[model samples]
Target chain A: MDSIRLNQLIEENYQKIFLLALKMLKNYEDAEDATQDIFLKVYENIKSFRKEAKFTTWIYRIALNHIYYMNNKRNKEISRFPEAHEMRTEMNANPSSVLHEKELFVSLENVINLLSPRQKEVFVMRYYNQLPFKKIAQILGKSLGTVKSNYFFAMQKIKNDLQNQNLLEFQE
Target chain B: MKCIDKNILLDYLNDVLSSRKKKHIASHLSECGHCRRELEKWKKILDITQEFVDQDVKLNPVPPHAHITQRFSKLPQNDESSFWVRYWVKPAIATASLIFIALMVFFFAPKTVPELTENYYVIDNVTYTETISLEDRYLDNLETLYLQEIYENEELTYDILYGDWQNYEEVLNDLDHDELEELINKMYDNEIT
Candidate 1:
């Protein structure tokens, strides 16, 4: 460990970063390796993290950038995540509670891909990483109100899509 | 508690609401079935998301961290020695070099004001002194040589023959007999040489 403080920071944020990258890259091995690379980048450039933004926000910003670069290199769009075909075949075999779970899972995955990039980012940072709106705003360099608004629109879209697919019962 | 705003329910489910708002929503949720259903819907959504994240983490193994540990040992630590090297040692060397340059300039700069020296001169037939230059000494030597040659040819020269020597002769009359005799012997000796 470089220091107890750095180690503590790494431990605190590692899982969230890994999950976030995994979601963005949609490749397990790539995400895992990118996660390590992100941490190393954080360690190398930690001194430049301004006191204005919270440390978590700064870390999130770096993780986002690294994932984006990897995605560009792979020439991947948001929709081109893990093979849905494989999961579909597997879900077809199980038709009980597993199907229910798979429906919700598949609905979320579909809705996620259909989201606008900004909305998707806000959605991921909010739901998957469980970050606060205020932190997301700082990380994205937007106003708190703007972040809250983006999240609002993203959730509305998800809820709307779910209703269209009959995943949830709601007015159009 | 009126039917909750769907956005409020979402915030509530996501735990982004303040604790006070949360309590208010919780009470509303307890009393109201419609709001409760709305909250449940968001709660389900969040639960599914949370599950997805957890499942990913659990299934995908975190890579081996041995390299990070190995790299750290080779990396320089922020110790006292390094701090001194960074903050003080380099500056000290630079400062020492600047002082050395200043001192060299001070010691070796060309002087502007000429030095004063004692000069010798005669006033009222009494000696006074000042610094003498090489040119003044040379001129004095040349003057002495010219005077010597004139002295040797002083006998019957036009200036001497026609010159006013009456006052000099009167002064000579006051001289002692032995001095006058010595002068006459010297004059005859110079004329013959």
Candidate 2:
């Protein structure tokens, strides 16, 4: 793709991709970096993109792959530098007031971040990106049933977590 | 009559069901308290998640980076000739050269026939056939092993496992007494759950 078309693609997808990265990575700085890297990858590989596939689906595939790569790399780094990771967690935990005021959000983010890789990817794509399950299946290269089940399981987990914490109330 | 499938309820939540199906679900929700409660639980979760996302976005607006576009402008142009030269022309030339060399060797190379007794001939033929069969099986086994490794190691393995909030444990472990007390104080101050 030419620079003009590339710019257009970037403009259209920048926030959506960033949000996916944010939800997947759970850190603002890392998400920003991942977003930049994903777009750069898109720019480099635009020639290999076939006209037969939907552009958004193709872009989403690239974005998800990049996020997974980043996550794996981060996991390896965390395992390598356990002390530094603990210190950072300590620093982030220092802001107790901010966290307390938004405990539900923090808890929700925690539940989301803890989801299994497949479930997290499906949930982020469906909930945060608002992509249809069929489109999510196309992007993830999984069957539609697999995508929907992953999403359902993710939702069930979130509901159970909220209920256990008594963050949500409902008549029995 | 039966409780709605969780997947269909999700579809209803997402508004992806067809209007007729959507109406069917709506009517069912009125009569089935169990399904209605299920839907309400999902709806509340969705609403809360949306609120969280909204607050996050408000706190951190992602403006597009100018440096990315600047870098894009610096990338080499996708010239068609360069593509063919890199992907097609060089490989084609190499293939043609190999074919030509093979043809030359077939036509011009000297061939020597080995003298063999009848017993030696039979033994050699049997050994050759056995070697060929063994090699074919060996190659088939190797290919299967390689493909199995790839399938197992593929990055996007969609296993059907539910999340159990392990990170929440990690977070709880990271907090000390003072931090926990501060967090509780703030929660009480804000009257938040």
Candidate 3:
């Protein structure tokens, strides 16, 4: 693909892809860098994508591979989930809203970090990126049943984790 | 009504279930308090997940497209490295690994241990053939003369002595000039003249 068409594709998918990267990598700056890198990769190999799958599927495959590689490369450097993004949020707002946001953020981090790598990918792609399981299956090269099961197990695990932490309480 | 599984309830929450299936699950949830509670749990999980996405999306806003395209223009094409990655890297690694493994196997494989007595022979002072080495100085005059005579004539009946001819150089040295000349004349009658 020419640079113009590649530019358009990047513009269209950069945010969603960045969000997926952020959810996976848990750092905004890292996510942005990863997104840019992924787009560069997409640009480099766009001609070879061969329309057998959706462009998004091919792009997402490149993205997840790069993100996973970065995760492993930076594993030693980042011990805890990245709280730098959370820290940068405005704390001048209402204390209660701030606390609620902070609590939800912690719970989210717990669920994400505690999940198995496969479930985490499924969880982020399913809910965070709001991708359909079919597309996720194509991107991951998994059977649709495998993708659904991964999503189900991820959601189930998140539900259980939240209950254990009392982050989710039912009304009487 | 029997309680539906929480996973199906999750699918229902995501609007992934078919209308017929949604209705069946809804009917069950209405009658079953436990299933309703399970639905609440999934709903809470969904909310938390959405919050996670929303918060993250808010944090890492995407870059401007023009800037990304500009960056793309700045990046080196590096087409060769990409081609190598796409085509050759795995095969190269596989071939290298196979060679390494083969070498390791070749160097470490067990074989018949060498026998200690293979090179050890007993010295027989009593029953032994004479091992007389026809030794001589490398360039003794007589030896050189003999070799020269043989080299000059391909057909020589008396050449290349193999017996224990000890001190043949001394024998030649003992001869006087006349005797030496006569010996050379006899050794190569036509060639010397």
**Model 1 ranges with Cα > 4 A deviation:** A46-54, A76-101, A168-172, B1-3, B18-34, B69-74, B79-193
Residue B41 local lDDT, model 3: 67
Chain B TM-score, model 3, reads 0.34
lDDT of every predicted structure (CA atoms): 0.70, 0.78, 0.71
- Model 3 chain B: weakest 10-residue lDDT segment is B130-139
- Two-way lDDT contest, 1 vs 3, winner: 3
TM-score (C-alpha) between model 3 and the true structure: 0.56
Give the Cα error of residue B49 in candidate 3, in Å. 2.5
Residues B39-126 of candidate 3 have per-residue lDDT tens digits of 7767877776787767655654565656666654554433436667768997899999999999999999997656565333343447
DockQ of every candidate: 0.14, 0.23, 0.22
User: Alpha carbon lDDT of residue A55, candidate 2?
Assistant: 83
For model 1, how does the per-residue alpha-carbon lDDT over B1-193 read when each residue is reduced to its tens digit? Answer: 4688887887776677899999988888889988877777777666666776555445555556657534434445444367788799989999999999999999999976653443333223246433334357766875685577567776645566666687788889899999888888989989534
Query: CA lDDT of B185 in candidate 1?
Result: 93
lDDT, candidate 2, B1-193, per-residue tens: 8889887998899887899999999999999999998888888888987787666656666856888767767665566467779799999999999999999999999996664442121214343532223345666775685567557864523321223446656787899999889888989999656
Winner on DockQ between 2 and 3 is: 2
List model 2 lDDT by residue over A1-172, tens digit each: 5667766766867888888888777777778899999888887787787563488888888888889899899899899999998887667542222543577887877788789989988887776677888998988888988998898888889888999999887767
Worst 10 residues of 3 chain A by lDDT: A89-98
Model 1 clashing residue pairs (backbone): B118-B130, B118-B131, B119-B129, B119-B130, B119-B131, B120-B129, B120-B130, B121-B128
| Candidate 3 segments whose C-alpha is farther than 4 A from its true place | A1-6, A50-53, A76-100, B63-65, B70-193
lDDT of 2 at A147: 91
Best by lDDT: 2
